[model samples]
Structures are given as C-alpha cells and as structure tokens.
Target: MQLPATQAQLSPVAGDASNRRYFRLQLPLRTVIVVDAPPATEKNREFLAVDALLAQSGVRVPEVLAADQERGYLLLEDLGDALLLSRLNGINVDHYYGQALAILRQLAAADTAAVALPEYAAQLLAEELARFPQWFLQRLLGLDLDAGEQAMLAGLDAALIGSALAQPRVLVHRDFHSRNLMCLANDSLAVIDFQDAVLGPVTYDPVSLLRDCYIRWPRARVEQWALGHRDSLHAAGLLPAVDDSTFLHWFDWMGLQRHLKVLGTFARLSLRDGKTAYLADLPLVLEHILEVLQVYAGQDVQLDAFHDWFRQRLQPAIADQSWSGR
Candidate 1:
C-alpha cells in the first residue's frame, strides 16, 4: 500500500455477471486487482463482510488490501486468472473436482449464524423461479402462456420451492461454478464472487458445481460426484443419514431450480444489460433443465405436467433461437 501511485500501471480485466468493473494494477514487485463496484448497485459492504467471514473460516478468498465502501473501490490480492473452467478435462476432472468439493465442506462448516446471512427461504426461491417465466419465456422467447400453462408453471414452482425448503441449511456460495473458482499456481482452488452467499439448501452449491450452467458432465459422473459429496457432508455432520436416491433427488431438483433461474438471468443480461454473450450459454442450461425434468417425469403430477408443457410448447420456440443450435 506504500507504492508510488504514478509509477503503477493499470489495465482493464474481464469481469463477471455483475455491474462491477475490474482492473489489474501492476506495481514494482507484485500485481493487485482494483475493483470499481459502484455502491448504488453493488453489495460492497456484504462483499467485505463475507470476505472476512470466509477468510476466518479458512476459505481462500482474495485478500482485501484496502477498501472504500462509500466510494466503491477495493484493492485486493491478485489471484491469477486460471479459472477452473479452463483446467477441467476428462482425465483431470475427478482430481480437480475433489479439491473443489473439499472446499465446499469447509464452506458447509462456516458460521452462517455469525454473519447474519439471509436465508434462502421459500419466498426467495419462488421469486427466482418466477424469473424464468418473466424474462425467459415472456420477454426473451416471446411465449405467451395460456391460463393452463401458467397453472402448470405455478405448480412446478411450488414443487421446486418445497424441495429447496426441505434441505438442510448451510453457508451457500450461490455461484460456485468453475468460472468463479481460481486454480492458483499452487494447485489449490480459491473462491470468488461470493457476495451473494446465503444460508441456503445444502445441495445448492453442490448442484451449482456438478451441473454447472457453462459446462456439462455426463449424468452418471455428475450423480457420482453429487452422492460422494453427500457422504462427505454426512461425515462433516452437515447432513443427516439420507439415502442415495433421496440425496440425488435433492441434487437434481436443486439443479432444476438453478438452471431455470439462469435461463431467465442470461436472457435478462442480454436484453436489458446488453451482455448478449450470455445467450450462448442458454442451451446448456436448457439441457440441464430438460435432463432433470426427464429424471423426475411421472414421479410428480405437477412436474410431469410442466415437463410435457416445456417440451411440447417451449421447445418449438427455443429451437428457433440462433443460440439453440437446433
């Protein structure tokens, strides 16, 4: 923090799906990240507070060297840009994901009570589910639903919200996907963009990683990883004695809720924020949603109705989109 201001060089860096802008500050001996997260729209205070919470719990978040919450600027330790997404492969995925899952264990043990984090409650879950219909179906895809279709969607929402509420609550890194994970030079993984952390479903972060919106692993492998995590959670005393089928049901349904929210989120990012690049990722998210729907088909009347409606009504419209590749 004692370096000459004029001597240091600053350059733009790629940012995440937020209003924040980031820059790299090159000093004589080291580099740091300079973040411009406008306070009006960004959760600067929460970021700072959560950073302290995670750090105290031994989670590797970027060190905050300096901060000005009112002005919305932060100087942070530069965790280099080796995103976990870029490092994944068929051979190395098991090893890398094992490391990531270990971190999730630490996260599960973190003191959510101390931080006063918001609960991922039924209202929040339902609101997120609503985004799919509002932004994706109506706004982006221009699908005008009839009353019956609306009822089907409502039923699906109730089912998803109920499933989420049924899970054990833990410290959730809401966006625990590969891109937010930095594979440091020492081969350890570091978490970022955790300002949205909450006391949420135990399966939420696991599903976020296993069935990532940006990448797809085979169903068998994903299920294996998910169930393995469930065992780890049980060992850590974070989960009760739940069977594989029940745990997988939790994981799959959690993933469905997340993917549906992402569909609308990506659409809103494109239409409202002009970040059209997110549109390219929609097909993978849609695929995740469909796979879950197939898995749970005929098990629940409402879900079955929603699944049928999605394929019969929505698929035709989605197929026409340039990003759909259908």
Candidate 2:
C-alpha cells in the first residue's frame, strides 16, 4: 500500500466478456489485481457485497484490498493465474471437482435474504431464454422462422422456465464454470467473477460447473457426480429427500435452460460485441443442448417437437457454418 506509483509496474491482463478490464500491479513487495469496472454498467456494489458474503461463508475469494465505489476501481489480492480449467484432466478431475463442489456447498449455506440477492424468478428466466431466439437463431444463424415455429419456441421456453422455478432455491454463482475458478498456490480453489450471484434453483450452480460450457464430460460420469452432490445437499438439510430421477430431471432441465441462454449469449458476443472467439465454443454448447433434447424426447411433447424442428431446420444451417466443426 505504501509503494510509490513510479516504482509499480502495471500490465494488462486478458478480460472476460464484460465491460470490466483487469491489470496486474506489481509492487516492490507484492502484486495486486487492479480492476476497472465502470460503475454505471458494472455491478461493483454487488461484487463487493457478494465477496464479503462468500468470504464470511468460508468460501475462497479474492480479498478486497481497497475499493473506490464511486470511481469503480478495486485493488484485490492476486489469486495467481492458475485457472481450474487448465488443471482438469482425466486423472485429477475427480479430486479437483470434489474441491470445487465443496465450495458450492459453502455457497449453498450463505444467507441469500441477508444480502437481498435477486431471485432467479420466471421473468428473468424467460428474458434469458428469449436471447436464443433473438441473438442465436436469428442474428447468428440467420434463421427465419414462421409463426408456427415462433409459437413452438415460445412453448419450449415456458417449459424450461417452469422447470427452473420448481426447484428448491439457493445462493447461485450464476457463472460457476471452470474459467471463473482459480487454483491458488496452496492448491485451494477460489471463486472469481461472482458479481452475478443470485438466489436461484439449487441445481443451477451445480449444472453450471458439472456441465460447463467450455468443457465436456461423459453423461454417465456427469450424472454420478450430480447425484453425489444431491446426496450431500440432502445430508446437509439443504435439499429435501427427492429420488434420483426427480433430481436429475431438475439438473438436466436446469442445464438445458442454461445452455440455451449460453447459445444466445455466445452469439451475441460474436455478432454484437465483436468477440468472435466465443463462436468456437458454440459447437460444444449445441452438443449439450441436443444431448438433453434427445434424453427428454418423447417424454415431453413440446421438447420433442422442438428437437424435431431443430434437427430438421436448424441442424442443416448449423452444419454449413465455419464454426460448426461438422
């Protein structure tokens, strides 16, 4: 804190898909992360509040060394560059994921009402689902849908939103994926980019992590990990005694809602935001969507119809895209 400005070295760091920018400030004795998150557009106040809440709940997060809320600047303890994504492999995924899941448990115990966290209610869920139609289907894929197709999509959106609202609510790290998790020098995992935390379905964060957009795992293994987490949540008195099928229905449907939103989000990032690198991730996201649609086909009439529409109409278009990897 006492270091002279002239002696400190500031270097730019790669940022996520947001208006916020990050820099590394290398001082004589230590280094810190300097964030330039514009207050008008960024959730600086929410970030500070959630950081305190997570720390108090015993979850690892970057310590706020200093903050200027009006100016939208923060000095955070550097948690190092070892993102959890870089360390995941077949040999150590179970171990690292176990630690990551424990963090989710800690988040589940946090007092959502104390922080007045926004609920992941139906309106917000519906708004997110709408992005798929606006950005992904129309803007990105250049798909033109007739009135019946639009009605079909609307029905599918309602189903997903209903599924999300039916689950037990908990504190959700809205982007609880590998990239947002840091592996500290001590080998403990820390959370980052948690400004969007909300009170949402219990399965939201779990599905965000287990069925990450940037990575994929086999269905059987993913279900095992998901059910194991459900067991832990039940034992902790956070989740009521529900059968495996019901829990998985909650999980898979929650993931469907998320991946659909992600499809639209990624497309928006590419077309509107000019962050085209996100397009490369679309194939995997689509894969996740199709996998769920297939699993639930014939069980839900609307989902089955949507699946048929997607394969018949959208798949051919998607196959022709440069990023489709078909």
Candidate 3:
C-alpha cells in the first residue's frame, strides 16, 4: 500500500475526538500514522512540542516524519498494536511495572528546559477541582451544593491545594496510563498523549499508571509497584529527597491532587466534550481519591468532610448510574 502524501486519499482509520481524524499509511520503507487535525477545530502545535521534547529526552515516542501545521496534518511513526494492558494476562506484574517505571523515569528525566509545562500549583488544583462542582455535581449528579456543603468543600480544597504545593516537582505525564503506553518491539514501551505534560510532583505519573482510571488494580499490589518505582528513581539519583517513606508521602499527596483533577476531567468530558466513555471510569478514580483521603487523615478538616460527603452522596449516584445504564 502506497502512503498518501495528502490527507484526502488516506484510508479511514479508527479515531477519537469529534474534531479530528487518524489514518494508517503504508509506504515502501515505513508505516505511519497520519493525523488530520483540522485547523478550524483542533491544533497539532502541542503534539509537535511533545514529540520534540520526548525525543530529546531519549524516550521512544512516535517520530514526526512530516507535518503541515497550517493544515493540521502530522505523519507519525507507527508504533505497533500491543498495548501493555493487552499483555498483562498471567504476566509477572512486578516485572511489567519495572518496565513502565523505567519509561517514566526517562520521561521525568527530560530536560526541564524543553518547554514551559504547568505546575500542579494551588490555583490550578483548585480550578481543576472546581469542575467537580460544575460538571459532576451540578450537571451529572444534578444536586445543588448548599452553602453548608460548599463551605465544607472550600475547606477540603484549601487543604488539598496546600498539600500539593508542598511536594517536590518533576516532569509529569498528565495522562500516563496503560492505554497511552505502547508495547513496542523488544520489550520496550513508548509514551503517548503527552502534549499536556507538566512539571509537578513525582507521584503524579505513577498514580496515573498504577491507579489508572481506566483499569483498577488491588491497592496492595499497586503500592508494591509504586515502591519499586520510587526505589528506581532514588537509585538513579533523580529525586531531591533521600528517604523512601518521605518519597511515598510525596507520591500519595500528588496522587490525591491528580485524582481530584481526573474526577473533574472525566465529568467535564462527558458533559462538555460529549465524551461519555470517560464517565464509566469515574468510580475507579473516586476509589483512588478515597484511599488517599483515608491515608492522609490528619491533613485538613474540610477535605475530609467533602470526601465523606462525596462517598455518601456522589458515590451512590454514580454507582447506580453505572449499574442501571449497564
């Protein structure tokens, strides 16, 4: 199959987002992914930035074979079909996690100078969490957070934000999960969807991988994997802190902040982006949130109360929706 130079003749391939199209192309020397991100609705500038940054960091991301920024066309190296999630059956969870951790280490090691990435600052965290009120609570759950409830949430937001800003900062793969990791040839992994990469706590990406909203793993097992990752980062001297337990605290706190952001993102995707597939993953995300809240019990009174209320009201409604819709 000859590769089409223009988007007009490429074969239709499976894609996502109501705004863009993707296609597989075959040339004499290579197979590539052609992304048609129409300028009217979508832009590929971030993708370009991410590709360059990952390549500079020695991570195996799809190479940008060619691009037409004006037309929103990108020809990317075609990483094969086996995703890490698909190969998990009966596999050694420890070893597979080792590979994932290794890849993350490389990404975290990326040059901090590459591009300006967002920090999981107090303002950003609270802004993201506010989506919970707008999308999940008001739109999805259809409930008004009365002044009392709102004040309770305000407290939790303040505490969570303070905890987030106190952690060490590093490169965070905003969506580091199984689906975004490609199982490349020779037992390697290639990272994807890193356009939203940011500078944040080390635990950010690990939580995204182990406690992924799309898939659930036992907390005990996930913890074990996370410890191993922490050790790897420590051994490489990539971390500012030296103590394992201290590192774990950073990870857990960062995770709490991320889960809150994800809950809001998933709800926003469903209500605003018309991407309801993410809604199905809300429970798993909330489970992570509750687990963090429970572990960090003494942090903030308001946070605990909001999480408590979340379990009492939001949990039942989301669970019921999932069951009845099924």
Candidate 4:
C-alpha cells in the first residue's frame, strides 16, 4: 500500500503498443513496475478489471500492489524484462512453447461465468476485418479494391466467419503472442497486455502464438505446434475429435483474420497515433498473412482471387524491406 522506500530509482521499460508507460522501480529488496496510464486517453480501470479476470482464470499475471484510479497509476509486481520473444531460438523454442501451451491449457478450463468479457461475435470479427481495407489498404498503402476484389473479400469473409464460429469457444488472450508473455524467475511465463481478452474461437490464441507478428517460425514447425495443441485440446475434452484437415482450416482462417486486424492496427498506429515503430513490424505480419493464404488459395476461387491480389499488391510493398522474409 506504501510507496517504495527512500533512494529507490525508476527506469523506463520498453513500452508495448499502447499509450501506457511502464517504469521499473529499483528498490533494496525487490523491483516492481509502475504503470502510468494518463486518465484522459487510456483505460486503466478496464485493465484492472481484466487483470482480475485473468488471475481468477489461473493465469500468472502481475499482482496489483497499489493503484490510483483518479491519478491513473498502479504499482505492479515486476515480471522482469525477459520477454518470451527474446528467449526463443532454435535450441530452446520447443521448451518455451511447451510451457506457453501448458498455460493455455489451464486457461481452457477457467471459469468464464465468473467475469464479464465481450464475445468475439461475427459482427465484431467482420468489423475488425474491415479495418484491413479501410485503414491498411486505402489509408496506408494508398490502394483501392476493385469490384471483383471486393466480391472476393466478401466470400473470404464468409469463409473466415464460418471457420471461426465452427471452432470451440474459450477465453482468448486476444494478443497471446511472445511479446506479451514474460519470463518469470521461477521459469514460468506471465501474461500481460490482456485488456482485450475475449470469448472466441479456440484456435485464435494458438494461432496468435505460433503465427506471431514480431517473430516467425517455419511452416512445418508451426503446423506441428498447432496440430499438437489441437490434440491436447481434444484429449482434454475441450474439443471433439475433429479431423486434422478440418482443424487446420479453422487455425489457418483464424490467423488470417487476426493478421488482417494486426495489419490495420499497425497502420493506424503509425498514421493516426504517430507511433511509427509499428510500421517496421508490418512486413512480418504481411508475410504471416501470405503464408496462410497460399495454403488455402487453391480450394476456393474467391480466396484465390484475394490471395492473388495480396501477392500482387501487398507483397511488392515489402518485397525489399530488410526484415521482409517471414
């Protein structure tokens, strides 16, 4: 309840893709993080609400030590600066991803009735998808969708919506990627940036992790992790014994929808919010979309048209960036 003892120092930590600022409080016995969420522009109260929800769900999130709602400040247990993204490499990815998946399994069994969060309904998903055209395509890239491309997008939207609604619904950390996951001292992962949690497709979180924006994995390896997670879900009775092919469809389309949203979000961050750093991450997200699109391109004509449009239009924009390859 009290502030850190005298002589404590505060050092800024790298901020996430948010308006909030975090600083590490260095004290004699321990370190804690302080969140400064200027009341006028940010939603610290919603963050507190979601924190309780995730903690009650058994995920290891930060413990709120002190908070000032009117001042928009909170003292939180420092989960350290070790991000899962920094820890992952060829030698240790499997080990870390295994732990990450274990946390997700725990989340699968959490009590959804206890906390109130919005459902990732079809309309919500469609609205998110619309950002791709409105923000990324028109605003950022200065491109327009032809009538044929628009029709193709309509069909692709129907496919994405159908696949998402068909999957088992569960509590989703919406941004359950490497960056938001912290590496605790005990070696367990702690989740953060979860104010956007939702009741959505079971494949959504898994796809977010494996098809991360800030990082990438081989297609074969990602498929292995994804299908392996599907097996665990089915074995736990969270999902029926859906065939691999069907589950793959759900996973692929879910990642596509998510990446489309991410692309628009990154563009909006740069153009509207004046956060130009996210523009650098756009290439990787585009690569993720292209990877999944190629897999599903042949089966549907409308999808094929959209995929061709992406390859022709979006691919060239990033074809030369240094971090372009996924």
lDDT tens string, model 1, 1-326? 65677887999999999999999999888999999999999999899989999999898999999999999999999999899999999999999999999999999988766787898998899889889999999999998888988888888888888888998888998999999999999999999999999999999999999999888999999999998999998988988999998888889889999999999899999999999999999998989988988988789898889888887889999989999987
Candidate 1 residue pairs in clash (backbone atoms < 3 Å): none
Local error of candidate 2 at 251, Å? 0.5
lDDT assessment of candidate 2: 0.93
Best candidate, lDDT: 2
Pick by TM-score: 2 or 3, better one: 2
What is the descending lDDT order? 2, 1, 4, 3
Per-residue accuracy of model 4 over 1-326 as CA lDDT, tens digit each: 56556776889999988889999988779999989989898877777887887788788999999899898998999988899998899888999899888888877877778678789999999999988888888888777778877888888888888889988889888899999999988888999998778889999999999999989999999999989998898898877898889888888889999999998898888889999888889878878887887887689776787888877876786565444554
Ranking 2 against 4 by TM-score, winner: 2
Write one digit per residue (lDDT tens) for candidate 3, span 79-190.
9777777876536556667878888898777886857776767777788878878877787777887898888878767766776677667888778888888887887788
Candidate 2 residue spans exceeding 4 A from truth: 1-3
Off-target runs (Cα >4 Å) in candidate 1 are: 1-5
Model 3 lDDT-worst window of ten: 1-10
Candidate 3 clash total? 1
lDDT of each: 0.92, 0.93, 0.75, 0.86
What is the TM-score of each predicted model, taking all chains together?
0.98, 0.98, 0.88, 0.92
Model 1 lDDT vs. the true structure?
0.92
